[model samples]
Target: MRLALAQLSIESAAVDDNVERAVSAIETAAEEGADCVALPEIFNVGYFAFESYERAAEPLGGETHRRIREAAIEHDVSVLAGTIVEDLAASADAGEAVPAESGLANTAVLFDADGKRRLVYRKHHLFGYDSAEAELLVPGDQLPTADLGGHTVGVTTCYDLRFPELYRRLVDDGATMVLVPSAWPYPRVEHWKLLPRARAVEDLLYVGAVNGSATFEDASLVGRSTVYDPWGTPLASSDDDATVVYADCDPDRVDEVREEFPALRDRR
Candidate 1:
């Protein structure tokens, strides 16, 4: 399948503009023959927009998700709607299973080409270092994977990349590819690049690290969105530009890499 990592320019608290940009990216990816397109973290609301988290929070099937779902159906491509600030109470009222009854959560949803809600992954790790993310949003608890376009896909967010054990769990659950929607910033460019590459190497799966491109009041995003193969080889990458990084990935590559290396079999 062809995967496109959308490196979007996220404006702080600019929900409408950002969502519009995301939709445009999806359309462009479909035009480029991408089977699936993944956006960066909090594409609607900038990740550094802490004060606007509450105001921008929406339910699972809120306007932002509805728009993304519709785009997927219209474009005939699957979409990973990056991450959004979710209103847990509203989601619960809408009959969606939420991690909490109230408060907010950083959530990512996957929509199939037919506009089916394939997977919902809330961020398991909430970043608190020099940010109000931990204080403002609730962390996700479930680690789920879904099958899409002949690949077993897993979802993770920015901070979740630091946790290798989580990736191992997904591998155990039969994941062949993992999409990491991130809003990584400057000064930590090495960390952002290294972690996802390491995850792909360790799990022997496709790792698509999607990041945003924008400068906020407190931080500036490092837009090195990349797609790594099972061999830790970068298939496609961008350099801090708002563009779509595309890579053709085959699920069988994961098995082939594992069989050739025979490293995962040695795991204790």
Candidate 2:
């Protein structure tokens, strides 16, 4: 299937403008015959916009997600609506320690071609190094995967890319491809480039990483959206610009590589 990665800039706290840009990218991708389009992480509200979490956080099916659904339906293409801040619901009956003021989650929502919500993934590994994510968000417990146009797909967000165990588990769960939506900043461009390729090679699966183009106070995002095939070869990549990177990935290639190499069988 042909996948389009939309690497666009986000105006911090500018939800409407961001949504418009994302929708436009989706339409353009669909016009180019892409079966599925993926956006960068936190495209709705900029990543690291700590103060806007309370104001920008929305329910699972709220306005931000609704806009993404509309765009997917209009374009007749499946969409991975990057990441958004979710208002965590309470376990009222259990009497558990439900967070007051509503907990926050870094979430990614998937809309199928017919505009049906297919899957949702909350970021498992939260970044803590002098960042707001460590202090502000609640980590997710479940590792979610879905079927997208004959491909077994797993979803993850920024920071999760640093953890190979997560990708290994997804591959074990029959994920032939993984989609990572990120807001990776500058100065760590080497990590951004190497990690995804390493994951693809180690897991024997396809890896697609979409990153934002926005600049923050401390650092600017390195917009090098990239796709790696099962053999760890770069299928396509983008420069530091707001652009859509495309790649045609064959799901069967994963099986072929694993069968030929049998490297996964050596895992203890």
TM-score of each: 0.99, 0.95
How far off is model 2, as Cα RMSD?
Answer: 2.7
Residue-wise C-alpha lDDT for candidate 2, range 3-102, written one tens digit per residue: 9999987888899999999999999999999999999988998996888987888777788888889989998999999999887663223342333335
| Model 1 lDDT per residue over 77-189, tens place | 99999999999999999899988899999999999999999999999899999989989888889998999877899999999999999999999999999999999999999
- Provide the overall lDDT of each model, using Cα atoms, as 2-decimal numbers: 0.95, 0.88
Error of 2 at 218 (Å): 2.2
Clashes by residue pair, model 1: none
- What lDDT score is found at residue 268 in candidate 2? 83
Model 2 lDDT-worst window of ten: 90-99
